[model samples]
Structures are given as structure tokens and as C-alpha cells.
Target: MAVPPALETPESDGDATSGGPEDLQRQSWTRRTFGAVIENPHFRNLFIGNIFQFGSMQMQLVVRSWLVFHITGSFAALGTVALANAIPGLLLSPVGGLIADRAPKKTIIQSAQIYNMANAAVLAALAAGWLGVELAFWHLFLSSFLQGGVNSIMMPSRQSMISDLVPRDRLMNVIGINSSGQTFMQLVGPGIAGFLIAALSPAAVFGVMAALYFFAVTFTMRLPTKPLYAFAQSDAGRAAKQARSGGRRSNGFKDLKDGMRYVATDPTIRMLIMVNFLIVVVAMPYTMLLAGFVKDILHKGAFEQGILQSVQGLGAVGGSIFIASSASKGRGKMMIGWGALLGVGIVAFSISTSFWITLPIMIFIGAAQAGRMAIGQVLVQSYSEEEYRGRVQSVWFMQFSLVQFGTFLVSILAEFAGPQVAIGGLAALLVLAMGLIALFVPAMRRLD
Candidate 1:
């Protein structure tokens, strides 16, 4: 891609074109872009809201897996729960992306949060002993489905909104900070959930998650209303017209086809999608198998499991902070190189037999993953036009949903080949993927 033109200097009022020392400092904290929209209170609310939202989501994920395993003692059940969460997003996310472009983003995000809150409330009730375990499974599955739908809507809006919050120059930094916050939450939330589950009931964890969702809801509600861009408004009008004419299907293969077409035409985005798919397919399932790794392989229990998970998250937090601090220094290419190194670290993780050995490797893996993700976001957002930003983001989210497929495949492999072998195989696949991307996608390699 061509190097983007330099951003115009911001004005003294911290507006998009004038510049000064105070403006620079404010830009450092809020904008990240030379001429971007960083200082908006609305964006700050959204960013803060995301911390609680993503943190709660992560906590519930760890807690739910543990709870289900504790109750059923079945790896298959754990896989099934993952499937429940993944399928809806995979199926519905494209439509959600279209909606995000056409509808008001803040409203879309708020509605999704409300739906998410409801899901958590139901789960909390089940955890509090107001519902039966059998009923809990059904509720959990339903809630996962709902959450998946919400994510389909929420992910694109949240991602695309960042550019609107900060300028092009600071986009990389903002993404880094956003990712760092996510990693920070991952570092703390799991440990908290694990401790709570160990001391109290699993239901208590759910209750905590519900409270976090409530907080997110409050913050999201406070977001300032921003008008849709002209292209977005046009798309919305077209969609409405099609709906009125009975010519459009909200949920169908056609919507998926449109999304696929958008992704197919953009080479950078296509490569990014493929890489994301590979990562999810190869790396993410380790979380699913972690509890088993702790119990059956490592001969440890819940506390150790939590520590193992927390260590990886700590690594991610460290990585994210590093990226956030230095992204503006123009080392995007180097960061991608480090991401490949992270894959190597994950491979090392698979071969290790002891916690002492695995912990440090996992931390490095986290750092590498975060760095790659931060840089990758910068590349994708920079390359994509505002007209298709939501659609591009949806494609990215779809890769995440499809990661469940990888997880399921790996889970089955674990049953037949064992977790160690399965993980090792995934590591090899990731290395192979890295090599291929390095050879074929020079743009990605150059971090342009």
C-alpha cells in the first residue's frame, strides 16, 4: 500500500488542524492521530466500557469452562460450550456488520450490551441456585447464543469506532492501548474468577460478571450520539428499501456472499483474515485444553490452572503495554517479526512438561501474540477505507468465530492423539503458516 500522507496538524483548540505543546500532550493521551478525533468524551466512555465488557466476558469464559467441567467432568461438554458460543457469531456476524454500517453505532453497541446483560442475569440466576443444573446447561447454551449474536453486532462497531475517536497518525497507539487494556483484564479477571470459584460457588462468579455487564451498560448508555457517515447512511437507506420491497433477506447466504466478496477483493484484508484463521485454528484451543492439561497432565488443580492462565495473560499485558508505548516509533515491521517468534514460543510451550518451564514460555507467547495483534490492527484499519471499515472489521470478527472450528478439531485430535501431541501438531501448523505468510505476503512482512 502507498504510504499515507502526513496528517494535518491539530489547531490550538485541539481541533484537527492546529498544533501546540498542550495540543501535543493532549494528543499523546487522547488522539494518537495528528489530526484524528481522539478527545471525544464519547470515545473515552466507549473505551472504558470495553475494559469492563471484555474483562467480564473473559472471566465468565474461564469460570464457565471450570463450572461445566466440575459438574459434568466431560471434555466433550467443554467443547460443546465453545461451539455454542462460536456458531452464532459465525452464522450471523456478516448481517451484524451490515447493521453496524447502516444503524447508529452507539445504539447498536448499547443494544448488544443490554442483550449481553440479560444473558448474564439469567446465568447468574442459575448460578445462585434459582435454577437446576440441567436447566443451567440449556440456559448457558442459550446465553452463549445470545452473546454470540451481540458480539456479531458489537465487534465491528467497536473496532470501526476507534478511528473516529483518534486520528490516523495515532491509530496504532490507540489500538495498542485498547489491546493492552484487554490483556490487562485478561491478566486479572481470570485469577479473580478462579479464586472466587474456588472459595465460593461458580454462581458467584456469574454474579460478578453480571455486575460488570451492568457497569458496561451504564457506560455505553452515556456515549454521545454520533451521526452515521454519508456512505453508511446510503447503505442503510438501500437496505431499508430492499427490506420494503421484500427483496432482501436479513439472514441468508446472500449476506454472507456480500461479506465474502468484500473480503476477497482486498488482498491485505484477505491475507490478514487467513492469518487470523490460522492463529485461531492453531493457537486458541489451548485454553479449552488447559484445565485438562492442569488436571490430567500436570497433576495440578484449579488454583494452579488459574495461575497458568494468569501467567499467559500477564505476558500479554506486558506485550500490549510495550506496543502501546512504542507503536508511534515506527517499528510495525519488527512487531510482526516478533509475532512469528511468539508462534515459536507457543511451540516451546507444547513440548514443556513442567509448570516452571511452561510458564515463562506462555508469557512470551502472550507478548508475541499481543504485539502481532496490535500491529495487525493498525495495518488493516489503515489499509481499509471508511466506506468499508465495518465490513472489513466483520471479516476479522468472522475469523475469530471460526476459531471454534479449530478448537473443535484440536479437541477431537486431543481425544485420539492426546493433548500434548495435539498441541505440538498445532504449533507445527502455526510455524508452517508463518513461513508461508513470510514468503507470499510481502506487504504483511513489510508491515505496510
Candidate 2:
């Protein structure tokens, strides 16, 4: 048996990989499912930090909404709180991405965590009525908006930093692990928040969430400030530096413009972005109608609704683990399959009347959605140039914001056409959109 040339002379760097062209030629993947995440200390920190952060994020959502409802006793006020939480990222994530590209990602991540910690602490105090400060509408609204801004910056930095952690061969596996971890936290955090609020207090839950943010900061602080790959001397690196320094450094909009131009010009990158956006805008919102399905269609209560949601979360974790354990090949086709499956699953669930039937249906729906999320992210990473990775992911984050708008649209349509019909129509549209993407974007379909 002949030893491969790559194995014959492994690169001399300690981590032995880059986020750029050096990794594009990788011919073999790590055999262990979690080899990348397990072996790398930096990534281990990131993984831990992410879990803590996600748990806090979920806790905040529950606590914030609960407290707002208690204070105002109005549904519209609750909607206003959710809007406050969403608006910052919708408007500022591109700017956040630009900051990520120009600054060290670790610094940005840790800084954001610090801000979250402070914000959480203050909000917790207000909830506790500390300093005799009133829990006014503005207080809740301001905290929610600030958290959104912190998230707007933190998300892109964290995601783009993944490219720096492991060998390109292990990228898919790492992403899958991270995605699954997030889904697991989403399942856990809300439950914990509910318990905390019932047993302790909303203020106590916020205080605990603040501690989680601090935990995230502790882990993130240990991450290396510099990328393992020595890109400063590489050709692309030099060009990237030159591109940034030549008057483009003066204006943030120019940097954003360049990122948009790059996405617009690259066929594969553009297609992948569009596909991911479509996935969010269409298939992701099925979860929004879950309450309607459980309450009206299934003739159930909060307990049954919680059961159905938990089933989907479990399925999401299962699906993410499935993707992480597999070797990469036909990733593009798999993405298409997942996207279509999501739509099909939603349509199937819309028609099913039995609790048992809908349970499995939600599982498959969760799996399909999780798979699309993991695959769509990996595709964007693979297609993007290293110079633009942060900015590119920023745009991806921005597109994710529009998903709320899509869900709102779905709610409006559902008012007229019934929930099942509205959901089924969107699912059908998802299938048709994916089919068009596959047909027109041959480069995307052909991606590995």
C-alpha cells in the first residue's frame, strides 16, 4: 500500500490547517465523529461557551416574555417586547459583520458576552425591584434591544471563527456538533426557565442567566486571539489586507458593499445563500403554527403542546448528530433532500389528525430543518473566500432576521385560509422553490 503524499509530510503548524485555500484540497476526512471537537482545546472552549450562551438566550426569552406579560397584561405589549428583541439584529448585523472582519473574533465574542452579562444583571435587578427602580416598559424594551445588538455581533463572530478551529475535512462534523448542541440547549433552557420561574422567581432566573453569560465569557476568553493558520503571509491574506487598507478602511458601508458584490458575483456562493434564505423564509416558520395545531387541530392543552415541541427538538438533535457523523459527499443533494423533506413533513403534519401520527411527523420535520441548517451553513463556508467569511456570515445572519417577517406573513394568511391550508400552501411553495433552485443553479447542485 502506498502512503499518500499528504500523510508522508504533514504540515508543520501545531494545529495543521487553515480557513482558506490550503484546506480546500483536503482529500480525506477525520474518521472519528467528534475528533475535531474533542481534540481541539480552542474548539472545546467554543463549544462550552456556545452551550452556556444558548441556554441563557433561551432563558432570557422565557423570562422576558413572562415578566412583560405580568407587567402589562396585554398581548400587544408582549409582541412589542419580541419586536424589541428582534429589531437590532435585523438592522445592525451587517455592521456587526464588518466589525468582525476588521477585528479579532475572540475579542468580539468575549466583549459581547460581557455586555450580555451586564445587561442580564441589570435586568435581573429591575425584576427584583432593586434600588427601588420601577420595572417600566422602557427598561424591558431597552434590555431586549441591547441583547439583540450583542447577539447581532456575537453570532457572526462565533460562526466565522469556526473556520479557524479545525481542519477543513472536519468542518462539517464540527458544525453538526455545534448545531446539535444548540438544539439541545433550546430544549433544555426553556424547561429550566419555566421551573426557575415557578419555584424561585423571574428575577432569580435572570440572575442565573447572567451567570451563564459569565460562564460563556470565561470560556471565550481562553480562546486564542489569532487564527492557527498563518494567513498574514499568504497571497490571499496580503490581497485582503491591501483591499481593506486602500481607502476602504475609512467607510463601513464600502466594506459591506464589497461583501454584497462578492456574493452577487459568485455563482455558487450566491446560490447557497439564496437557498439558505429560502429555507428560513419558507420551511422554518412551520414551528410558528405549532400552537394552533396543538390547540385547535389536536384538541390539546399546554402539556400536549410542550410534548410535541420537545419531540421536534429531540428530532433536531438526532438529525444534527446524523449529519456530524457522516462523511461529506453529495452534501448539496442532501441539502435539497432535507429542504424538500421539511416541506413534505409540514404538509403531512397539516393533514394528520391523530396525536401519534403528528408526533413522528414533527420528528421528521425537525430532522429535515436541522439538516438544512447544518448543510446550508457548511455550504456557505465552503464556497466563501476566507477574506470575506465573516461578512458573508453576517449577511446570512441578516437574512435570518427576515424569517420573523415571514412568520408574521404566515400568521396573516392563516387568519383568512385556516392554519392547515396556510401551512400546506407554504410547504408546497417550498418544494417548488427548491426545485427551481436545483434546476437553475447547476453549480450549487453539483457542490460537494
Candidate with best lDDT: 2
Estimate the TM-score of every prediction: 0.83, 0.91
| Pairs with steric clashes in candidate 2 | none
- True lDDT of residue 360, candidate 1: 83
Q: Judged by lDDT against the true structure, how good is candidate 1?
A: 0.71
Predictions in order: lDDT:
0.71, 0.79
List candidate 2 segments past 4 Å from native: 1-31, 230-233, 240-250
Please provide, for model 1 over 130-212, each residue's C-alpha lDDT reduced to its tens digit, 9 standing for 90 to 100.
87544456666677777877788789888877765555655665677788889889888877887888899787888888788
Separately for all candidates shown, the number of backbone clashes (residues 3 or more apart, or on different chains) is 9, 0
Model 2 lDDT per residue over 382-419, tens place: 66777677888988887656766777889888899988
Model 2 TM-score, all chains together: 0.91
